[model samples]
Target: MADVFDQIEWNVQKIFDGEPVCVHVGNAMECELKRHPSYPKFHTEAVRAGVQPASSSRLWESLIAMGRLSDLDGDCTWRLVILDCIIPSLRSVSARVSRDFRVDCEEIRSDMVATALEAWKDTATGVAPRNVRDRMVKAAFDAAFRQGKATSSERPMDDIEALSWQEPTAQDCKPRASSIIDVDDIRDADVAEQIRGERAGAMLQRWGCFDAVHSFHDEIRSGHRSGSAGQAVKTSRSRSLISNPNLYYYSSDLYPRHIGLSEAAGVMGIAESAAHRLIRTGQFPLPVARVGRSYKVSVRALMHFKDIPDAIIHVDDVENGALHARDAVP
Candidate 1:
């Protein structure tokens, strides 16, 4: 049993190193099976070694079930089994980074793949248990999260806020002067028609009604001529132009900069009820801020538990020094 485990571990490490290994029946034929291509070769070798075909087939099936081998697209590749085990954890790590750091999903996934490749290169020979998936996840996540932290540090938090919804102001509505050609000066009929359209578009833009006009035009093109249909289109267009302030406030202000109880639980990958219990028991690592009936947590404070640098300061912390107050409290 010990010898078999050692051989399996050795073969797995070789697969990680980009070398292929054969799936064999038993210890007697193990020496002859290294890097053999197909099941036919294994069967022939086993039969020559006085082993029955039924025994060899059963052993192959058991190995496949145990994830010691993989038959992908008619080719037996052992490393793919390891990859299958780690893929779900990799996706979870990617989600966590996207949620916490607000990094692009594609960029985070690419970074994780690179991290996995690098880690595989450095892996030593050892008999890892079937549940080594979690370790792979943590390793990949740590690398990707560190890269995300560096990226977040380069971009100011205010930039993220600015990209989110901001209330439209007078400055936003201020129209710039645009020179329009007189339609009478154009000789070509088509050119004159184009100029008139451009002038109309400019006027609509200045009045902040271009989208409404566009929607109306689209409805006309789609043959929705009824008064009720026109009214519905207008209403939908107006709603689309106005950003939802609540969604903006929660996603931009509360999520990344401050960790509320629910947000903290999501970051820690735990249940909201469990997170609330931890906070009430004072077992949560960071200090929670009480803002009226709701609670907020500093992202900086959360970093302390992870031993990461406190690069971010919440807006509430800057204004009310809530972080300092929470720190000062027992």
Candidate 2:
């Protein structure tokens, strides 16, 4: 337990590094300490030393009470009080994003902590009890998603270019033409190119070339209209690929499963209205994916609010021949 405490203290120092600690964050740390196996021993020792356990869940409260009992005193002890809370919350956010985006959790967590600390330091009073974690997580999520999209784009293009270089077979070269609009019908080349580019971008987006779609969008925004009429025609053909039910075939599988607002509220132990208020105020730790008029919450994201253990199962437990022992009398 001393080793565990020492490790935790070291990790906390690495996280905060002399930053001012917030009370809520301190309380979070106390809760984390309570989860440790040695906490009961520490608590019993404190009881013997005439320190009453505080009713409040605040870590600072517990630490102050215990500190008085242990005869151990220091400003460093007080400084680390809130780190238990902040580190876990940041870690939870990182884990959720990493799972969703299939990125490295530790990398994201480090970046988020750096961003949060910088933002925290920039504040006039150097205190942000509520918004700090949310802002850090959101920024981290955006960066991770962008990286995932960019990576996805690069792999497919390599395969596509390789396939394009192959000699066309009789079947491959066969005319598979759709209804073609006459170029004579269009007057302005720029207008034609813009229309075509938009269509191509939409098609790229549907095909999950999100980065390519973004690149095309940037080109359009930058007003580069130097391409050939064939390019315009290609753009026109591609741009009209609007997302239909068929287009979103894998969206359900690709996207994370989301719970309703009621479920989210229940998990947080708050009223539905309060949950809605938090979302409306932009203070919610996780972002709500808008599904039409309703907001859908991620179950993974909700896990961040609670102390749940990893859902792993071991194979050795059922090896005792309990299958044969069952219903022996029946």
- Among all windows of 10 consecutive residues in model 1, the one with the lowest summed lDDT is 245-254
Candidate 2, residue 125: lDDT:
44
Give the clash count for model 1: 0
TM-score top scorer: 1
lDDT of 2 at 24: 28
Q: Quick one: best lDDT, which candidate?
A: 1
What lDDT is obtained when candidate 1 is compared to the true structure? 0.43
* Clashing residue pair totals per candidate (backbone < 3 A): 0, 11
The C-alpha stretches of model 2 lying farther than 4 A from their native spots are: 1-81, 99-102, 124-259, 262-280, 284-330
lDDT tens digits by residue: candidate 2, 1-330: 233224555765565564433332243355543343233343344223221122322443444443233334434453233333334334444554454445665565555545544553443144332333334334444444444444332221111111112344553343321113332246865444333333232323334455533343344334442322012111222223232111211111112357788776554434455456557656666778888888898755555343222121111111111222231213
The superposed Cα distance between candidate 2 and the true structure at residue 161, in angstroms, equals 25
